[model samples]
Target chain A: MSALIDLFSVAAIGAGLFFFFAGTVGLLRFPDSLTRLHALSKADNLGLGLVVLGLIPRAENPLAALKLLVVWALVLLSGASTAQLIGRALRRGRK
Target chain B: MSVLPALDVGLALLVVGVAAWTIAARNLFASVVGYVAYGLLLALVWVRLYAPDVALTEAAVGGGVTGVLLVTAGKRLDALASAEVGVPPGRALKILAGALAALVAGALAWVVLTLPSPAPSLAPAAAEAAAGPGAGLGNPITAVLISYRSFDTMLEKVVLILAVLGVWSVGADAAWGAAPAPLRKVRPDGAMILLAQFLAPVGLLIGVHIFWVGADAPGGAFQGGALLAAMGMVAMMARLAEPPRIDSRKLRLALVAGPAVFLIVGVAGLALADNLFAYPQNFAKPLILFIEAFMVLSIAVALPMLVCGPPNGSPK
Candidate 1:
């Protein structure tokens, strides 16, 4: 049972690492600010969510797992809003 | 080659890399973003050092609140389209400054590497206070802040109040009592407003939970109050709420309440206990918690005021 859980954790965390790597590449390679923001928001948000989920089963307690979830949620909220705000500013600047 | 050690080595390298990027990034906004990343990375360093309380503060205040403050300043500067005004430094001066900075960094690194074994720390003293008569607080950081060194913490609160006043002093005489300009964007996006509306209540709850749990856990007044302040700034930015008026009595009261209560308790302690800041044996825990409650409120108010600065031309 423990071995199975460990394998699951590794797979989930590995997927998260992949998204993070993808996000960085997209950030550097994307042609424009809006597209870059899109890449970052999507990749980073899902990456963090998966990482948090993978760690939950390893948490010492249920509350600790929930706290991890809350951290991811807060980051998600902030990242989404930040990307939108920047996108709006970008369009306005060109106008 | 344990996983933990490898993670720590990678984190240290990442922190150094980001710190260098923060200083070297060509654009102001990029530099500020790098700084935010650096702050977050430093929080991880703090965690690795077995200082979760410090980690929370580093992440919330160092990274989160400071990031918002700088981004706001960057936006305002971008608006003015200000030309680069400073004289370009000659190569000789730049080299001298770089060499000096490198020397200082090397010295700091050497000190860390050669530190006395076992770290000659005050941990034992802090541990005694944590478990002893100093409020029976489980978290040593809170015990030291609220019980052992309450005076220093009280003074820190006063410093925050002074900062608020200093910002207020810079406003034009006619702008007193006026609301600061709205923090909204040129054309606020609908999605952000929805996010703020959903996030603010949840953030506020977590903020209070952090404050409440500080007595027993890694969270504390500073971390919780910063979260509260972050929520307020978000709501203001989303155009969901107006900034409080400068001359409002309630605003002034909340601003001073933390330090004021802390001071009152310290004065009362002289008569009620062995010395100033000493809570009578049975009442220690309750008194400390009472003071912390007010400190959180005051911190929540003071940080937003600092971020917002003083009142603008008219009430919004």
Candidate 2:
């Protein structure tokens, strides 16, 4: 049972790491502001979520596990909204 | 060799790389962003050193709040900078400055590498008071702040309040009671407004929780109060709320409340406990908690006000 959980955790963490790598690649290669923002927001959110999920089982208590989820959720909310705001700013600057 | 040491080496390298980039970045805004990244990396370094309380402080004030301040200042200065005369320094001067900077960096690295092994630690003293005293706090840092070295903490609060006063006085005489300009962008930003509303409640709760848990954990008034101040800044930036006028009675009261309460408690200590800031053994925990709660309130208000700068002058 513990081996299975460990395997799952590693897979989740690996996938999350890949997402971060992809996000960095996109940030460098993306042609424009909006696309770059899109790449980062989407990739980083999923990356953070997976990382949080992977680590949750390792938490000493249920509250600690729950707090991990809250951190991910908060990041998602802030990231999406910030991307939107940045996109708007980019538009205005171009105009 | 364990993975941890390797990770630490990588982290240190990353921090140094970012610091170099931040210094070298040509654009002011880009440099500020790089500096923010540097601060975040430094926070990780602090965490790895088994100082999560310091890490929290670094991330909140050093990275988050300072990032906002620098970026905002950079934006305001951009237009002025572009209009000013441009003068490029000779290569000889640049080379000389670079040599001096390298010398300083080398000296710092040498100091860190040669730090005495079996580090001179005050852990024994800190832990003895924290555990032996009936303070009953789990965090040694909190015990040090409020129980052992509390007068220093009170005086630091005084310094913060004085700094805020200095910032306020920079405004023109006619603008004393006027509200400072808000941090919002030119457009009516719907996304920012929605974000502020969504995050502010959660952030405020977390801030309070950080303060509450601080008695036993890594979180504390400084970290939690910074979070609250950030929430306030987010609200102001989204145009959801205006900066309060500098002369508001209630605002001034809140600003002074922490230090005042702390000072009063200290004086009372002089009479009751025979020394300033020394609480009665039985009542120490509650008194510390009471002091901390007010400290959070004052810090949360004062920091954001400091970041907002002063009210706009009549004719700048």
Candidate 3:
């Protein structure tokens, strides 16, 4: 049972890391601000979500796991809102 | 090879790179962003050094509050469009500055390298005090700040008040006692309003939690207060609230409450305890918490006021 959980954790975290790497690449390679923001917001949020999912089982307690989920949720909220704000600023600048 | 050393090396390199970028960035805003990043990275370094209190402080005040303050200043400067953009330093001045920096760096490096093999530390004594007859607090950092170094801590709050007054002193005479300008000149869109509405309450809860836990844990008044200040600033930025008038009695009271209560307690100590700043036995923790509660209030108020700058025009 423990071995299975470890394997699942490793696979999830590895996948999360790949997404993070892809997000960074997109941030650097995207042609414009809006597109880069899109890449970053979407990929990094998913990356973080996956990372949190993987770490939940390894948490020392249920509260710690909940805390991990809370952190991921906070990040998602802030990231999405910040992206919107940045996009609005970009649009205003263009105008 | 152990991964820890590699991680340390990488962090060190990253910190230096970010510091260099902060100094080298051509755009003021970009430099400010780099500076905030550097502060956060430095907080990580503090954490690695096993100083979670300092880490929280560095992340909150150094990175978060300072970032907002600089960005506001930059915006004001851009609005002014004064000739103060002025001249860049000459090559001779730059070289002189570089030489001075190098000299200071060399001196610091030499001092660090020549330190005693077994570094001198007061940790054992502090721990004894914390765990025994002293404050009996679980966190030595809190004990030291609130009890052992109470005078210094109280004075630090006084210094914050002084700093706020200093910021206020530069305002126009007509604007005296008036509220500072709104933090955001631009009307924030719906998304920012939503973000502030949602985040502020959550941040406030976390801030208070951090402060409340400081008595026995890694969090403390400064960290919590800084977080509170950031949340307040966010609300102001979203146009949910405005900076209070400087002359408001309630506002002034809140600002000075921390240092005042701390001083009163210190004075009372002369009668109640042996030393001027000593807390009486058996009641140290409660007294410390009482003082800390006020200190937290003062810090939370003072920081945002400092960021808001001196009063702009007359009151609305």
Could you tell me which residue pairs clash in candidate 3? Answer: none
Task: Pick the DockQ winner.
Answer: 2
lDDT (CA) per prediction = 0.87, 0.87, 0.90
lDDT per residue for candidate 3 within B194-247, as digits (tens), equals 999999999999999999899899998889988998999999989999999999
Worst 10 residues of 3 chain A by lDDT: A38-47
For candidate 3, lDDT tens digit of each residue in A1-95?
A: 99999999999999899899999999999999999998898676999999999999999999999989989988998999999999989998999
Q: Please give the C-alpha DockQ score of model 3.
A: 0.86
Report the lDDT of model 2 for residue B87.
75
lDDT of 1 by residue, B32-62 (tens): 8999999999999999999999999999988
A best-first ranking of the candidates according to their DockQ comes to 2, 3, 1
TM-score of chain A of each: 0.97, 0.95, 0.97
Residue-level lDDT of model 2, residues B1-316, one tens digit each, is 6999999999999998999899888878889999999989999999999999999999999899989888877766775776224676789999999999899989999988988997787777867767644377878799888877787888888898998899889888888777777776464588888999999999999999999999999999889989999999998888888888888888899999989999999899999888887788888888888999999999999988887888874422
Off by over 4 Å in 2: B82-124, B132-134, B185-187, B313-316
How many clashes (backbone N, Cα, C below 3 Å) per candidate?
Answer: 0, 0, 0
Candidate 1 lDDT tens digits, A49-94:
8888789889999989988988898788889878877888899899
CA error at residue B91 for candidate 3, angstroms? 2.4
Classified by CAPRI criteria, candidate 3 counts as high
